[model samples]
Target: MEDIHALIQKLDWDTSEAEQAEAIHKLQDIQDEELRLLLQPLGKEYWDGAAEVIVKLGYPSVKPILPGLLEWIQDMNWPGAGRIAPLLREIGDPLIPYIQDVFRNHSQDEEWMYWIFEMIIDYWDKDQIVQIQEELIRLTEGKIIALKALRTLWVHQIYSGESVLLLLEDKMQRSLTEIAQLEIAYPGIDCEALGRGFSEAIFTPELSRAYIEEHREEFNFCHRKSTLHDFVSEIEELVSECMGSGNAPA
Candidate 1:
């Protein structure tokens, strides 16, 4: 193990590709904490090798290393952080709290953070939805990330109407003009089509109401069977139920 650690320490990224590969292969066999401690300083350049070694060491062995790995991710400049998605996926639910912290605290790093959220969404417990929604709302704010998060929540139907109503109200007031302009700027496509696309993309049902309200004349004559008020009523009902449940709306 000491010899293996020495070899890992001596490995140069500038070295020939063959030498790096050979070092990684040998490093995989060293399961001692002393060896891991020695190799920990290699940073992201060694992530591929480290991940391989950690995974091969099995979950029990790798469990001890997660906290350190998670701490490394908090460093914006950490090279090994980029490999976190795969590592967390490899580690599975045991890493959920760590990933959630990243999502909550790293609002500016939405691109990377979203992948972490995406990974954990599948395993989210129902009770966790309120917190997840709050995090999503806080992180996304006015950005496209909010839209994506909403879509994810919508697909899962995780939020009650009350939570959704808050989001709907926010979107109605904030994004109405932006969406209307999108319709006006692109005259060939009707508002319903745009609403459908928005609904599909953001998973917000209120977008449909906003679309109809903005273009009432265009859609009213074409679809006489259903009124915009009906949709609004449905949304309100959902919102009431969500609020009554006392869950924080996402």
Candidate 2:
């Protein structure tokens, strides 16, 4: 055990890459019992170096310690926490059940859920990630985690955009654009109300040229008409692309 600890200590970020590789190779060579025993220290503390070796060792090697690793990273701000994703990604489909467990049990932890989306979920395939799409959509109903879940869906292209908008738009009156504008808007009658009204008018149901033209007087931009026209055209084009690829409701 002392020898395992010494080897793990040698895996530190401060160590030379060559030396870290050497330590990893040595750890890999250890007998199965010793290797399994070494993993027991994981998530018990911030042993940053140990993560890389586990990623290299892969799969069943870390199965016993998987739950602890998940819990340990709930802090999200831990140094070298980024390395944990590669290990989890390497574990691949085997990590799905545990991820579902986290979503099921820890859905209330917005930051933890956000961390899972930002750092971990993107590395997975759409099929693997879709298992949690329902949960992700459910989280969007909450004020705090909505943006994070929406982003995970949008950025990953996890669902057809129309499907996502349909699933969420009625349940959530504010479009992502409207929500973002309101969230960042200064708290005042002029600034807040204009942002709210403008975003809702432009984004609700569909963002189209006809809609923008019909509500043109409501657009209070200081820019020239051409600029506003161009902006509206761009948004219209983007929505068209999303709807084109989406799986529409039957």
Candidate 3:
């Protein structure tokens, strides 16, 4: 086996372009499994440069790296930990079967399921997205992960992100006398995401109320029990104002 110590060292972010080129060349000479090793980075917290090199190498760099990623993702916090999502996007549709399995297996792990869905989003057509959504919805029925899947449905334009966020609005609510707590009913739930749904203005009140009313008893809602009249009035005002604004973009 060729020694990779120097080559890995040269791939550091601080290295010159020519040095990086040489390191990349040496990386290309390494076997696929070893190439996957190079992704560890020349130094700690150096994912940017390492990810760039991996992503730039295109399909070859990503293929062998994926199985490990499929496992690593289980422990990862997406949109925060690393650039792996972009790298996975470079891997693309060819890894569809693998990702589907990841989502299927980790349906209860909300963040992992979210990122895996994101990595594979662009690859699936609307029809495929719908199929996947229905399957996940069934597997995750009445759980927090079902709300997470709603985010993906919004991304595919099959549902509005706001509408999905609205579905979680009740979870974010609390009466003045009461404190909000994570819904104990659903394990591994992501309450902050539900909070983000409103803080970010990604909510459609009418849509949220319809869902809340439909599943009033079954939803793992963590909010204080507010009066039905109050909820109705809130949705009505939102709908009236929105209609006046020509159904303002959700």
Candidate 4:
């Protein structure tokens, strides 16, 4: 363990790229279950190096250590914590099940779940991400992590906006409140992400028209009243264009 810790120290962020590469090479040379176990505890102390070694080991070789790695990264302040994101992304689809487990077991740990989503969720392939649609929707109820889920859905173009609205109305309501709180927490931060998400999720003429009609009062009540009303107007115009052309609502 002491020897492994020394190797990980050599991979610290302050080390030169060449030096880190050399350390990575040395660690990769001795990959095995024992070495992998020794590397786990060092994740907090030497994550920069430990994560690189795990990334190189790849797939099934590193699969058993994933839950531990997930736990290790809960502390964003840890050394080389940023590297853990890429490592999870490199592990790719194989990491999804473990992430789903985190969602199940740690549903109350919104901060940890939010960090996990921020670090790796957007980086995963769309096919892999869709595996957790239910969990993602559930996460929309989270005070800290809802924005991450909403952004992932918007970016990936998963589900119809109306469907997302119907299935996740209560949760989306909470997510909107969370977004407002986030704007307060970080003044001048871009809150238009919510608007963009709404646009992407509810683009169809029927869905847009129905949503505006049903939720117009809610939009009027929003803190950013003018911005949301403008969004509703855009949707209404799309509805009018479709109707003028004699296209049935879809």
| Predicted structure with the largest lDDT when compared to the true one | 4
* Colliding pairs, model 2: none
Rank list by TM-score: 4, 2, 3, 1
lDDT (Cα, tens digit) per residue for candidate 1, span 1-250: 4476556644555657777667666766665464346334665455555544554555656676766665544443555455544555566667756656766676677655655555545456555655566676565454445655654465456644445567867754554455455556555645457556556645565766676577666654334323334434444555454566564444
Model 1 per-residue lDDT at 235 = 44
Question: Cα RMSD to native, each candidate?
Answer: 12.7, 12.7, 12.8, 14.0
lDDT of 2: 0.61
Per-residue error for 52 in candidate 1, Å, reads 2.5
For 135-172, candidate 2 gives per-residue lDDT tens digits of 77777666545645655676567655665556444434
In model 1, the clashing pairs are 44-80, 161-238, 161-239, 162-239, 162-242, 162-243, 163-249
Better of 1 and 4 by lDDT: 4
Candidate 3 per-residue lDDT, tens place, 171-220, comes to 33422222223234344544445545444443777766665565444444
RMSD of 2: 12.7
TM-score head-to-head 3 vs 4, winner: 4
Greater lDDT among 2 and 3 belongs to 2
How big is the positional error of residue 214 in model 4, measured in Å on the Cα after superposition?
A: 47
Which residue pairs does candidate 4 place in steric collision?
161-201
Off by over 4 Å in 4: 1-23, 38-45, 163-250
| lDDT by candidate, in order shown | 0.56, 0.61, 0.54, 0.64
Better of 1 and 3 by TM-score: 3
lDDT of 4 by residue, 1-250 (tens): 3365576778666788898788788776554555555344433545667777877776667666777777767877766566666777677777888999999788888767877876878677678878998898787655346546755665566744444344344544544565566556656433355455458658687877776676554444454544444434443443344445444223
**Candidate 1: what lDDT?**
0.56
Q: Alpha-carbon error at 214 in model 1, in Å?
A: 40
